[model samples]
Target chain A: MAFLSGLSAFPITPSDRGGHVDTAALKRLVTRLCTAGVDSIGLLGSTGTYMYLSREERRRALSVAIDETGASIPVVVGVGALRTDEAVRLAQDAKASGAAAGLLAAVSYAPLTEDEVFEHFSTVARESGLPIVIYDNPGTTHFRFTANLVERLAHVPGIVAIKNPTEKPEEISSHLAQQRSMTPKGFPIGYSGDWSAAEAMICGADTWYSVLAGILPDVCLRMVRAAQNGDVEEARRLDATLSPIWDLFKQFSSLRTVYTIADLLGVSKAEPPRPILPLPALAKEKVAHCLTLLEQDLA
Target chain B: MAFLSGLSAFPITPSDRGGHVDTAALKRLVTRLCTAGVDSIGLLGSTGTYMYLSREERRRALSVAIDETGASIPVVVGVGALRTDEAVRLAQDAKASGAAAGLLAAVSYAPLTEDEVFEHFSTVARESGLPIVIYDNPGTTHFRFTANLVERLAHVPGIVAIKNPTEKPEEISSHLAQQRSMTPKGFPIGYSGDWSAAEAMICGADTWYSVLAGILPDVCLRMVRAAQNGDVEEARRLDATLSPIWDLFKQFSSLRTVYTIADLLGVSKAEPPRPILPLPALAKEKVAHCLTLLEQDLA
Candidate 1:
């Protein structure tokens, strides 16, 4: 299997009360993820609050993850930014930190054309030594990459993998078709939508970039392993077990809900960046109930 | 009436073939809007491609617009950014550039909370010497300001007005109701959804911050004037005449369509920044037909 395949844990970069990244907590979390027998780890992802942190904070977060992981598994750092120059700078920093790959989203406040999206990635790819995983999260970027655009980006050197967020099942299938027909053989594609991971995996995604894996590495890994073994029944059973949590993700942003769950599970004290508050009281009750069910099922 | 009242023209920031801001063309456009009798001119709006331009480029664009207008009308500069410090810097620059007011959207790649929204504007309001118009453009920002949040922002000393983009009539009515109950009376609410301006005005908006006003200032002003004079029938008649163009705006982004129309009218050679292409060929034909129909109506 490729380094990018399997359950890659996107760990939260926990912060201090003063809103600064807590390097000690981050290191501890990375250590946990690395030893948890997951395939890889991703730092500075949306779950990592990459956009909300300062560049220096992001660098420190990546460096801590890399230093602690230290070749145990590949580390991918999110280098998405508002401008090409800023993204290039972050990608360079990630490369210097010895990250194996840089994850980039064509983030723009203004709407971007397909050509502009191609240029943004090509520029970052040219500047960075690490391989790039195109992060296609249109819900946040508001810049949707058409299958045609993704096919065009696949031709860019260093863009070796893709992490697609949830869309309709047909949309995912179309993207898979594009990847199959347009890209070279074995260009690993992963699914980031936790709720739809089993369906995506069944549709031939090479990996599951699992947010649930951040805390429940074992549980998430079991689901991916089932899919890998072609046990569709078992995969569906595992996904059904986690459907309650996924339902919560659909109601509120995963970033906010995950922080609340992490707190409940005694995993991390990580909170989402200010302006993105933790789940409200009602949502928290639902999350607690779901977590209880998850724990009960595992028990 | 306040400086923000009546029709505010959001002029496009003209750019040359090489994608540099055409300051000379921008100045001429500003001059035309000012002389055409717009109540105010909003430079560097979303229509101004504010996010695509560099800070220095944005500053130059604002300087040219302010210089060209020369106090004949208020020049509201869009000072929104992804980072709070960057937004503060833009607001400071807008103040230094002799702009009459600063227009700010809570632009973010990460979703922001109500408290974060309030903090962002309060910080900018403290630093900016000019009056501030809180731009509630959730479509672009992905950060919706709750009615409670807007009521809170209204209490900020320099946040003198609100320019709400188009939402459902019920949403607009609810927001207006909240404003009426929460803020001090006559807090200068305005509408930016050009297609919905007459309807928003009838619901008690104080002005229209219009993209159409950039090209057809007279027609936009006539609609606003009709609403102001309690002539809903006349306003609906005028709006119906422009429904063909409004339908085009609905089909594609107003930004791309406006650039094409501006080109057809010999106003400016301004194009959307790279990645936001010009109107496709079929859309161009539709736009041309709409323009022809509009010309005959005006004649």
Candidate 2:
């Protein structure tokens, strides 16, 4: 895996009733993703409940993911922070802990000034031993990174790839087109939206970061392959069938919905973390319908 | 004094660059509050960066507030939780640790189901000795707490007051109308809206929580007294004088604005914790201007 450019199944972590990280269930998830032969193990991404975990838990989870994969797959630990010092510390920690790479979010709690984001990433990149990927998970108001900010970050010390989940496809594509030098120079932009992966790829996104891949890695990986092989027909077919499940991720909380999907697939363990309330009975049934559809598709 | 009629100032905590709680600064804050004689010492509320603090930091803060005040005033601690169990634990911890009462928010991070909210508060109230108030700091979410929900919650165990900070003035008044019957005979239905404390009090709010009070308690307490004395005209006059100071609190990050206000008033020795990022120079100047307004009012 040359710096992880395929289907990255960011495994959803199962939590205990006590809200501690369920390492036992996490082990089960790694085994499943390993069995499914996911391109790279991305732990502590947004879907992985990265922000919710305490520092010790985050460190332990990243270690677990890396140790479980056993160098067979690259492990990219998510290392986003609101403070520059904190992000840099995490980056340093991630590199020292043997992570293959670190994926950092654009901004956190307080909105970053143009120079702050650049300085923040530049420090992290300079300090970390491994390659760094920028994460644009601006679902919350805390971090709203504009295209200009990305450009400022593009030249930061060691940024290698980016996972952009912005709503605008044309804008992303246009931005990439303007910075045509970035991709071949090895800065691949990945698309994170499950609903728009195919379209994003069509719009110059070279990689795919799948939250849906947490439950159905094979299906999503196949869809990505089909799209790349210029099999738009095959890709669209899979997307249409998977749209229901994909919609559910955003309908409820992503952490909760993904955990439910994992439970339905019987791949991960029961229960999600605190702050993320569980699926109501009706939501569980709705999720089950999507699972059944995927089951039928597999059958 | 009977049920704290209007404008409870949620003093912003001072933290060092490393994010440790500024205890010396905290003592100064308490002394000022005691001297000012606000209805209550509303510690650890949202304006206090409750969400950003650790458990130890939270407990230490509550201890500091109570110790400085002695028996002179009541100290209300914000013991909200992201998890029901954590909320219960914090409530018990707060009660044992000497918070006069707990002014808990619905929860952190996740939106609450009406049932979950009831269960959360009831469990905390049942387990803890402290009188618990239900705080609806729903600026935390896209979700708003409805009057019907509050009405339903009135029957839940241990709910004393309703702390609402909504743009909608009617929400708390509506809850008060229901709470008049549901609350156990005595207590208040308080509303907090930064600078609009006089207005919220005029509309039947028994408590107004102020951030500016953490810095210049005398100015805020006098305004509260003016409002309580059936002097809306005088209160409005105070409101006109304090408007500039209030404007500063509104314009910047709550944590930063409050901390700067604390610094200007010569209260806390601490700054915002490491990860909160830094306030801009312009924001610092605005806070200084806010302090100048306070000085003018006091003079």
Candidate 3:
């Protein structure tokens, strides 16, 4: 459970054009996360294209990541699906495959009711016995999780934590405080959106659920460690230094930007599943430029 | 192509909890649409829980619907998937199975760019050789289609028409006019959202992509016929008469409400795929009452 409290790195699941998991390439990514010592490997997250993969492919990805991590780093698998039964089956697979927790998003196509989402989370948790992290990602799923709903789910038996979307830097403190006050004491609250995640962690958020960390874990880990040690100035300095990469992330979503970075670093050369194209050439140039800047500054 | 012009009924694809299509139940629903003389059958639409079913199940539904309708009606199958290649395959299946056209939504998990969607649609249309209807469903997909994007896609070789989400009733005329002015001449523009569809049809939108019509084709056909014949008063009257059902649709979603209606009317007893629960007891009672009122009034 404590593994859920630090820098959880979400990696892109390396796959071919046909959506089959490149298990060898995926293990390479997981090896990188373990080498950098990310607190947990967020396998099959949105960044991992969990929604695009078949259940068998997802199982393959999780199995590989779990095997690669080898009890050194916990793997938090994304078990979200449009159907509840499918999610339950996914969570079951993650549990059986040795994932530490299942990150469940309210992945919807019907624009689900809060009650339906609650029942969904509750059902998956109860049925699968996998510790669940409530993944509140509205940017993709379009289902926003309100504080009330988050608090309610936080109290559910197997629902242990939340991975909230980032707030504006100035709002991070209050957002964290409000969420902290609403949920059970000591229940971990994490933040995604790499740009603002430093501020969120500096504001005493429990974890940084980061897209950048998925590929560039060492620098992200430095930021998380700085914030963890209460070195607010050091964390802000790293945040400021990474501004160019953050700008790239903002421009060409973190998912696409990191895919380019992973390829540039020779970690994995897989394009995202289609409907999600790789960054265009000019964007790739910008991402490369940002990477060069990050290497110079972070070094 | 002309069949895309009038009352295009979107029936729910009846399926068990496991996402297998109930071909018998589906055939019954399609038979009703055809017997009631709907202009076209929109198989595997959002109301059909197309997003929830597997591609094989989708093919089974489309195949059954096409066979049930025979040559009497054109079946526009929903060919949407999170992956572009999968969508292309679905479109190909629809084409090979004798569907008249493929209804392609910009279904996304990564929150696609307009350019990505343009490519996704273009690729499916080009690769499958199936005529495509741009399914602009922002409510479910959360990917909006601007008029500019629609104009561009409308010009894509195999892309034939669009099924836009409902606009405000008062804005239906201007919305229709704006869309018509932007797209190629005679490119069919349709509206879903059963409540506003009558007004949209009266405003000269080419089709009513109706959820209600999927189950209750006769009454909806009367509304469409009235609008087509330039009897705005009669269409509006029909719209007003169905206000209660629309209200239920607004409250419980047309998909959920229609499922209850289908069961009550002995059309199909299948519930929506999980994560989209059926109407609860109170809501079911309301739906049953509205059906009684509608039966008395429409009869």
Candidate 4:
């Protein structure tokens, strides 16, 4: 929970053409993010393609990231699974691998109840024996965690923070206000849905759980810093630079577009996990243009 | 594929308190459905809580249902998994256990592409050696199979039929129209969203892959028979009788409400898989009232 603020870069799991983890590329990506001074490295995030990899592959990916980053930054490993037992096992593995915390998302193939969702995190929290970050990504999981549910999870032991999606700005603002009013100060709420990160930060989000940071840590850091410093105009300006990539993400998923960006940047050579392909021709051309503009701006 | 038409009853998996599949209850359910002359029995379906159970349990459940039904009717096993390899393995196991066909759903924990989905099913089709029925339940899978994707899958060898969700009647009608225009007559399309079965059937759907049929096969068969005999008025009347339970399904998932209905009927003692709890107290009261009205009408 110590590095629970600022920018947490979620890196893609670089993989070979055979879909095996490309450890060398993964190490390079992690090292680059750490060198760029990202506050933390989130392994196995949606961008990490955690769901596509096997359990052993995912555990290995976590260890490789943690070992490469060393003590320079915290490592938050995504331990989400469709089943509670599988999630608990992954969380335990993250703890054994020296991850700073386990990010848990309740991914369900069946419709889940409020009590069931609460029980899922509570069980993972107790069994993993590591600080847990509740990942409320409804887009991928198709299960929304309402503010009321978040408040209930806040009281569960070991659940120390949250990575909330920022689809609805007004809803995010109202929920953050209600959560802030709750006792014990509530868990620190961070924002994903990178396109809306600036608005969420401006609305008092504690951290930016970002996909953009994974590929372009420096610019993402600058945006987060501007928001943290209350430099609203500067934050908006920095955020505008992410617009081209955001446009592609809106059309497709960030899960697909980010892999293309990483591949284009030569920071990593990852094929987005199978079943999810690399960007199509037009999308790739658009991404290349976006990267060119980003490079010139950074220069 | 002989049993591809009429009512294919998807039984709620009867599970013990510890969540293990209750084989005796499963057998009872299968015997009841088979005796009632339902066209086929679908095991390990969304209603069967396939994702909630582990691989071994799923295989065991399939075997029990197959054994109980004993070729009196075909058994279509839901062989959905997050990984293609896992799905193939399940499909093979279903074949080895004497299941008539494998229901292949592209259930991804990650976002997938059209080509990726095509490959997932095509690979399973070639490898499993079982007749494959593509299960297109986008509500659970989070990945929609466009008519384009379905056309692609229809060309895959061993892919014989489709169990399509009927959430949007217009969309289903449009897609079916587009699909019917393609050569080889394509695969037979079945409807799953029970509340809309009559509409789908009237729209030229080949079968009703029904959850309600698993518990109340006589009533379900009556509806399907009416549809089959071109008794649209009778079909509408029968479908209207399902409205009360359908109301519960719209509120929660059919997976949960059907379990409550089955429990109330004493046909089987079952709970929906973990993370998806059985209906709460108020919902249970509502289901009981609906069942009483239904029972009185049947009498």
Question: Interface RMSD for every prediction, one decimal?
Answer: 3.6, 4.3, 0.7, 2.3
Query: Compared with the true structure, what per-residue lDDT tens digits does model 3 show for residues B191-260?
Result: 9988998889888889999999999999999999999999999999999999999899888899999999
Q: Count clashing residue pairs per candidate.
A: 2, 11, 0, 0
Cα lDDT tens digits, model 4, B1-299, are 34488889998888865558888888888888988999888888888888877788998898898778887899999998877777888999998999989998888876677888998898888989999998998888888888778877887789998888775766778766766765247368788888899888877788899988888899999988888889999999988888887888888778788888878888776766555677888989998998989888767
Q: What CA root-mean-square deviation does each model show from the true structure?
A: 4.9, 3.4, 1.4, 3.2
lDDT of each residue in A1-299, candidate 1, tens digit only: 88599888888888863457989878877877887878889788988888877788998898888888888888988998866767888999999989999999978766677777898899889977668999998878988888788888888889989898885655777767777787778888888889888877777788888787876788888888898889989989999999988888777767778788778877777766554566778988989999898989988
DockQ of each: 0.29, 0.26, 0.90, 0.53
Residue range A35-90, candidate 2, lDDT tens digits: 88888877888777665566677887877777788878788888876555667778
Comparing candidate 2 with candidate 3, which one achieves the higher TM-score?
A: 3
Task: Give me the displacement of residue B257 in model 3, in angstroms.
Answer: 0.6
lDDT string for model 1 (B1-299, tens) is 76589989998888754446898888778878877889999899998888767778899898898888887888988998766667788999999999988999988876676777887788878966668999989777878888778888888898899898786655777767767787777788888888888788877778889998887788888888898899999988898899998898888777888898888888876767655667778988899999999989977
Best by DockQ: 3
Rank ordering of all candidates by lDDT, starting from the highest: 3, 4, 1, 2
For each candidate, the alpha-carbon lDDT, in order, equals 0.83, 0.71, 0.91, 0.83
Better of 1 and 4 by TM-score: 4
Docking quality category of candidate 4 according to DockQ thresholds: medium
Q: Least lDDT summed over 10 consecutive residues: which range in candidate 3 chain B?
A: B1-10
Native interface contacts kept by each candidate, as a fraction: 0.34, 0.18, 0.95, 0.66
TM-score of each: 0.78, 0.88, 0.98, 0.89
